[model samples]
Target chain A: MKTVLSIGVVLGAFYLLWMAAVPVMNIKWEVSQAQRAGVEVWLPESGIRAAGNWQLLSENLHLAAGTYAQEKPRLPSPVQVFAELWETTVEKKITSKRSLIFHAQVTLSATLLGFAMGTALGVVLAVGIVHLRVLDASVMPWAIASQTIPILAIAPMIIVVMNSVGITGLVPKAIISAYLSFFPVVVGMVKGLRSPDAMQMDLLRTYSASAGQVFWKLRLPAALPFLFPSLKVGIAAALVGAIVGELPTGAVAGLGARLLAGSYYGQTIQIWSALFGAAIVAACLVGLIGFAQTVVLRRMGMAR
Target chain B: MRANLNASKSASWAKDLNMIQPVIEANRLNLTFQTNDGPVHALKDVDLEIEKGDFVSFIGPSGCGKTTFLRVMADLEKPTSGTITVNGVSPEEARKSRAYGYVFQAAGLYPWRTIGGNIRLPLEIMGLSKSEQAERVARVLDLVELSGFEKKFPWQLSGGMQQRASIARALAFDADILLMDEPFGALDEIVRDRLNEQLLDLWARTGKTIGFVTHSIPEAVYLSTKIVVMSPRPGRITDIIESPLPKDRPLDIRDTPEFIAVAHRVREGLRAGHGDEV
Candidate 1:
């Protein structure tokens, strides 16, 4: 309850601040540009009618136009942005105005797919590397080194390489997410798999159980407590990878494309909205993985 | 079928009622480890035999190779030179045949599994069906007086209960021989005494041959039919004392003069092994 209230107050404050600041920032830019003689800028006045929702919040926050203020800003006010979100999200085809939701879906698809692939590959590699000394000595160093190269540098190269090889769209973005996200899963799972002590192994051995039985019964369950936390980290990393994958390519739809379109068209509202959407989506994805971990572990009788 | 059952019953019955071959026989068993310091002879040429239904124990100071001897018989360590036979088969063969079970000093229960799950582990490994495993688990839990603790994890249970669960694990597979390396050595006196009494009842009911290791003289005398006192620093057996106590179930065996006499002899054997005159 405390967290929810705090978050509401903070988000509310940010909205009000953004409402006042956007017009002021826009009006100043307009005047500077007007003086420069190169272009004209649009900015709303500081009055109750011009500030809009700031007018509704209180008179103390009311903004009257400064001497430098010009026409209304192109970007919507805070109330207008919320109205846009409500209209576009629930009523109108939101993405039709360069469709923010469609782009989010595109990025989300790549993020989810890449997260799945990366997590699967990472867990498999972790299990192999943890169990086998040869794999640890040979494969692990290279797997770790694979992550040292910056993802931004790798993103375009990945797109270019995939483009040359007839792969494009979601696959390229997912590959990028997988590339960035695999390391955390491997490291976390390796630690978890090795968590069982020698005595536990001997107990299994004394039962005359096979190596496979020991792993399935003992090591696998032991690894779970460590695995889920890493999965959350990996999923968030995967989303970042998807977004970064978008910046390089000339994609028409995705959170990245919406960001690019907003920047190009000077639609700061669209960019901020897309950024917020991306963050919320990433949080939800990570949260979903945690929920799955809880459910699966609870079913296995290891709720803690 | 009835005749075969009678024969099988008599086979185990031979240990108690008839002069039969020992259930476990270790002849001149020697083990030397290649250590950084030097080749340490962990076990000297040790000869021992344990009859079926024998509650035999090996008691000595630490580094006495009592544990090494147990490990040799369990086939956990390859002896430098030795021959160990359990139920007429070599130690290796007996291990492959799953003819014996082992318990370490600690409970050694899997932490992630429930107490009941730990007991069923060996049975599961041995490929028993689910129903058979369940039935055997219940029986063994009853044997250890842990019938209601089936679903509790090892950490949730008291140390004594966890140790009893481990005992259940050893007995679950129905192995004829049980090798215990000071199982009750870590428990408090009260819990240890309770476990010792229950262990005797288990031995009486199941007829499993037990070879235990402990430092407690009274515990050794209370539990074992024969106590093997050992001297350390390249361990050698100093004395093997046999008990002549009554076989009837009585909880006050410790207070009896006869039990006291047996315990006194065991103490003397231990003292002599420590190089003090008994």
Candidate 2:
């Protein structure tokens, strides 16, 4: 209920701002026309004049409606974006090219694939760094340095290179997502794997447990709390990577494609709806991961 | 030469009595930790022998290397110089054979695991059958008086109960020796006293050689058959006092003349070690 109230307030604020912008632009255009015609216009009691009468209230209302309902608006109103979302998702078939769900499905497939690849890679790298001194000394620094290279700059290079190697479409995009997602996992898992204190480690040593046994029984289980939070971050990064991956490719079948298409045609409503759609998808993914974390940790008796 | 002769004699004596061998023996043991601040002599020329079924306690102040000595016996630390054996084998070998169970100062139970799961951890690692693991877990939990807490997580239990669960974990595999480093040091006086009595009962029933480290004079006196008093600054043994108290000690026995006398001796030993440092 609180969330709903806050969202309502934010939407109302945006609507008021939108209503205000329309008249400001309209008056500026009208004043410029009057100056060009060499007519000395009197300042009306209210802001705007239309057809020589100070129809301020009616004209403002008309301008507001026009701004909100425009087929191609400079800044689409909330109702316009919401209507676009409703049309794309509810009016169209799921498999239709015009469907927001179709675009979302395309993006989600790559995000999930990338997330899985990233998680596996991160966990493997973490284990290597933890167990092997050479990897700790060599690979960890490189893993950290890899993240400093901005994904946006690297995504095109990766996509182009993979295209040259005859790997295009989903694989290139998924690879970008994987690249973005893995770093948090590596950092989180490494810290988690080493979370057991000196006494706990010594207790395991006293048992003469093998390294494998120790990993499975102590280190891995201990890393769970750390791992789940990282997975949430990783999945979000994966979605961002996937969307960004689509931007450079000019791909015509994802949310990123919809954004590009909307921008090219000046369809502000379509772009805004696509942005909201991506946010909702990312939120659902993270929420799903969080729910899984609670269940798993509870079963392990780590959660209250 | 004298140590060699004593070892041979004990071996023969052990055979004659059909008893378990000496649980731990250390001779001229020295452990120097090389830190950024230079070498800290954690232990120096420490000599000790612990036989099967003996309840031995190492009593000393902080930095006196009592815990270090216990760690050495558990193969958690390597001595810089000299030799230490656990159950007639090198510490590492003995550790590999699962000859001893070790309890740390804290309960050290994995918070993620249920009480039963924590107790069964070693059994699972040792690849015991599921039924056997459950049986041992149940038996050890019963021994530690935590029978119904099998499904409860470590955080749900009180501090003293958590410590008992840890002890139960150690006992699950039935190792012949138990090495504990200040396991009850964190508890309140009443809880510590109760645990001390329960521990003695556990010792009597199990017949395991126990090595305990503690800073408390009364605890050292009450729980141990032999108290090894130690001093810091090179970390050497000052005195070894064998308690004259009976094995079957109630909590009220802490007030007895014999217990008081032993406690007094331990206090003096600590004071004398301080005097030497000064």
Candidate 3:
């Protein structure tokens, strides 16, 4: 209940700030002389000529209401963005290209595919790194160094190279996502698999347990607490990687394409709505992983 | 079924043969650890023999090589010189044959597993069938007086209960030899006394050869048929005292004159060790 109340307080504060900032930030729509003739222009470009003009403006015009209700302003208020979101989602059919849900579906398919691929690749690499000395010594430094090169610079190169080989669609984006997501799993899992102390190792040795038994019974279960948190971070990174991959594809689909289209057509409202949609998707994905974490940890008797 | 009968017959024949041979024997064992401060002798010229069903306690101050000697017997550490054998074979071979069960200072129960699951760990690794594993787990939990706690996790139990569960884990495989490193050292005096009594009861019922390590004089004298007193600095045994206490004794035995006499000797041996260093 307290959490809900806190969230409400935060949203209300932001709304009030947005209302005050419209006039204070001087973000009124620029009126051509012809448009100015029909509508009363408060705070005209020429400075206020009289104290009576302030009264006239306050009585006849509401700059805050007008700024928020504009067809296009420098910054669209939260109301306009939400209204656009409602229209794109409910008023338009989901099959329509203009619908936000259609674009979200395009982006979500890639995100889910990329996330699964990334998680698999990460876990496999981690297991190899933990078990094989050669992989630990050789691959770990390279994994760290891979992250140093910016993802944006490499996204285009990966797409171009893959296109040359005729592997054009979702696979390319997923590879990029996998590349971004695998490092955390490797680092976290290496530490997790090694979490067993010398005494625990010695206990297993006394049992004369085989290597496979030791891994399945000890190292794997010990690594689980470490794995879940890394997965959460990896999924978020995978989503970002998927969206960035969309930017260079020049495709007229997905939230990335919506963002690009919004910029090209100067639709500030569209850009904001798309950004909110992507955020909502990321939150839901992370929340799903969190739900899984609780159930698994509880079954393991490790939950707090 | 006929082969099984013959197998038991041969096992009893092996036991008859083993009657004369000590279960664990050490000859001039020396282990020197190479550390940043140069070589530190963790054990030196340690010679001992533990007969079948004998409760032997190694009591010593810190760095006295008591724990180190136990580790060497468990094959956890390799001796730099000399030799030791378990069940007439090398430690490694005996370990592979599962000749002994070991308990450490900490309970070291995997928190993720229930008490029953932790006990079943060894059985599972040894590839026992599900029924046998369940049977053994139930048996050992009964042995440790934790019969009803099969499903409780380690954190759900108190410290004393957790230690008992760990003992049950060790006993699950029914090995003939039990090696314990100060298994009750962390408990309070009251709890420690209770565990000591319970442990002695367990030993009597099971007739297992037990090697225990501790620093407490009363703990050593009250529990052991033989007490091995050790000292620091080139870590070696200073004295070995044989206790004349009866096979069946109670907690009040610690107040006996015989018990006090043995504890006095142990304390003197410890002081003599420190005196030698000075």
Which number leads on lDDT?
2
Q: Tell me the spans in candidate 1 whose CA falls farther than 4 Å from its real position.
A: A1-97, B1-19, B35-41, B152-156, B248-251, B261-278
C-alpha TM-scores of all predictions: 0.82, 0.90, 0.94
Q: What's model 1's interface RMSD, roughly to a tenth of an angstrom?
A: 2.2
After TM-score superposition, what is the CA distance of residue B166 in candidate 2 from its true location, in Å? 0.5
**iRMSD in angstroms, per model:** 2.2, 0.9, 0.6
How many collisions between residues are there in candidate 2? 0
Residue-wise lDDT of candidate 2 within A110-188, one digit each (tens)? 9999999999999999999999999999988898899999988999999999999999999999999999999999999
- Runs of candidate 3 exceeding 4 Å displacement: A23-62, B1-13
lDDT accuracy of residue A39 in candidate 2: 58
What's the CA error at residue B249 for candidate 3, in Å? 1.4
Clashes of 1: 7
- Candidate 1 lDDT by residue in tens digits, A105-209: 889999999999999999999989977889989888888799899998889999999999999889999999998888899999999999988767766755667
Candidate rank order under TM-score? 3, 2, 1
**How much is A109 displaced in model 2, in angstroms?**
0.8
